[model samples]
Target: MNVETETMKNEAAPEIRIGGGVPVLGPRDTPVAEVVHACHSASIDQGLAALAIPGLNRETLEPVLQYCAGLRCVADNVSCPGCKRRTEAQGIETLDQFILSKKEVIVGDGRVRLKGEGTETVTTPCLETLSKQWSGENYWFWARRVIRKLRHGLRRAHMRGEPVAGEGETPSIILMEPQLADNIGMVARACANFGLDDLRLVSPRDGWPNEKARIAASGANYIIDDARAYGTLEESIADLNWVGATTARQRDLRKPVLTPEQAIVEMRKRISRGERCGVLFGRERNGLETSEVAVADAFIMIPVNSRFASLNLAQAVLLTGYEWMRSDAGRSLGRVTTYEKPLTEGLYLGRDRPATKEELLGLFEHLERELETNGFFNPAHRRSTVSQNLRTLLTRLNATEQEVRTLRGIVATLSQGKGRARKREE
Candidate 1:
């Protein structure tokens, strides 16, 4: 059963409220109803009644725990629907009904009806509802402690609960002779971060299922739990058809030294040829030996500074994996946000076509009239050159028909001042 349900079994009244905001220790046999009445009469927070119990044991007063423990399908402040129904059936009301009793309450999105009284339907309990009810500092302090203790459990409800592996032609990440379990865990985390799940460890130093490694991995338990340990690098990548060793050094070996992008493209080409591929990342302290690099088909080099060309085990894995995903044609590059119709047509802008030669000439004539009237052309001989230059500039802009019309409208507005004045004088 839950903590709240376990605490309800203990039959005891909370502290009795004396006059002047003082609390008198009630007997162990005091009823919950009397305790609630005293809290209401003394203007005390009803949830604070649990504080009256000596030593403040949560196990004994779990029913009155207002803030949510943040477990799966559970929340704070708002009463559980199951608990509410049970208590309502027992003829008990008001207690544990702090948020639900309100006729209407405001949440994050908008307003919500607490009861089935209005046209709007009663909304489900969410973060907004929980945050609204328990506004006490003391309550929040306890709530934070509870949340920290059960932080991992909070995501249990939303988790898919499946090992992420073998979606398509994903390259496996093989770590050769890793020293630290924390590094292994971090590598696993990086693999998970980039959707590369196949983690093969070649004889980790601290052994498999290391607690420190799991702790370092945080919530990436899937990669850690499914991590396979092999005796050697050869055994680790034996199932793979091709292998790429990631190193920062420039060696004298005859093997092709390819950048991360080139390595990923080669791996993809090999994958398309119905061959499995894996990238070998050496230990954290010293990277793969020259002999070990010889086994790989290519050397995957990250273009870093030549002076300090070293990367952490997880960093190398992450970079290579990112490049692999980048080169993979299956994955979408970014969020797709294309409209069904053409932008100009959907926006209802008149003249979706480009400006024709006739329309362009008409706009040029209209603008030339204004420029001539305003004495923009200082000399008549330079007028043709100036007009040709203007036409060339306008042509370079590739302004649409709508844009040409807009320029014409602007020219008409600026040049109509004298005509308006003459008409007024007439």
Candidate 2:
């Protein structure tokens, strides 16, 4: 089996040389979706050029190539053959591992250079930019999700009648330079889970209209479809009446630090007065920068352990969204479907009423008669005390009418005989 697989991998390379030497990524007659899938799968197992997909050209493959390259390098860092070979040889899968394996060269302008083997050098973005972009994402997993989207349409695409928030009803969730499309999708899901409708992205890392984001959204396709991406943070929040930037690190800025609950309250007040409100979340790698935070009217801080205050992008959005919907009058404890009614806090007694006092008395009398017949109260002197104790225990049950009937039936069956026992006695 191993030999056959190796032969197939070797044979797959030559099939790319067809139709005037244009590289095809899959076999002839392959569906476009299958070709895309093969391209991504081959990009992981082999290189991007491994597959020979028919009808796949540079123009058609540009998006996949860009996505693959973005996943391999950090923040527009150039991919080098030497670095690729070294990473493949050493089985280095993570960005941190790739960074550590190479020698860092600090240039005169404070820019970092990654020196790979044999004169191959790659220039990287600033440390802060690198930190913001490199999220330790699984490239292959992302590829599979993209492939899934190509094969099947967005999740819950057929479902309809999702509640839409009205104007000023909820705050717009603004994500500033989120690195992972998956994180953005999860943030959309979080937004949908609450009542927040508007989603704005400022300089998303992988670019907008990403299938990965749609796939990551699970069933919240509406949010993903409606999400707007902007080139700058200013452009993203220009229409908002007020904006709060969420962060864990304390900034020296004099802006008010409001908790998530307090921020939601302020937003609700502003929105009630016909003002648009928004919440700004920073990148997944590092939270918002000081300059970015300065743009917001206030700082929204969630209470957490001081030592470990950093949260995932979706988590921060989810927490803020929860607070926004916490006091909603129309909100149910959980989902309310056609068959399932909304529930409140208390014991649920479905289709059953509490036992009446007369029913309780009848049960007590029946149980006492059974006990007396079975000689359960052995000592005649203490019969009254034992009977009182039994009555107290039975009264405390607070059983329903159905429960009382079940108890009586149990007592009768045990005192007499049931099924096989009755047959044996006969």
Give the number of the best model, judged by lDDT.
Answer: 2
Q: RMSD per prediction, one decimal?
A: 19.2, 9.4
For model 1 the TM-score comes to: 0.49
Query: In model 2, which regions exceed 4 Å deviation?
Result: 1-14, 17-54, 57-111, 114-123, 126-147, 231-235, 238-242, 253-256, 269-274, 295-297, 375-398, 419-426
User: Candidate 2's C-alpha lDDT?
Assistant: 0.71
Q: Which pairs in model 1 have colliding backbones? A: 68-76
Candidate 2 per-residue lDDT, tens place, 1-426, comes to 697545544552212222321222354533223334444433322323444443344334545544443443333332223233235545676666656655553333655465543333344456665553333334434455544444554567665335467856789999999998889889988998897889999999888877667657778888887889999999999889999999999899999999999998898889889999999999887788999999999999999999899999999999998988886767777787999988776767788999999999999898888898888888878889988998899889888999998998787779887774355435
What's the TM-score of each model vs. the native? 0.49, 0.68
What residue runs in model 1 are displaced by over 4 Å at the alpha carbon?
Answer: 1-168, 177-197, 204-231, 250-253, 326-332, 336-369, 395-426
In angstroms, give how far residue 360 of model 2 lies from its true place: 3.6
Per-residue lDDT of 63 in model 2? 55
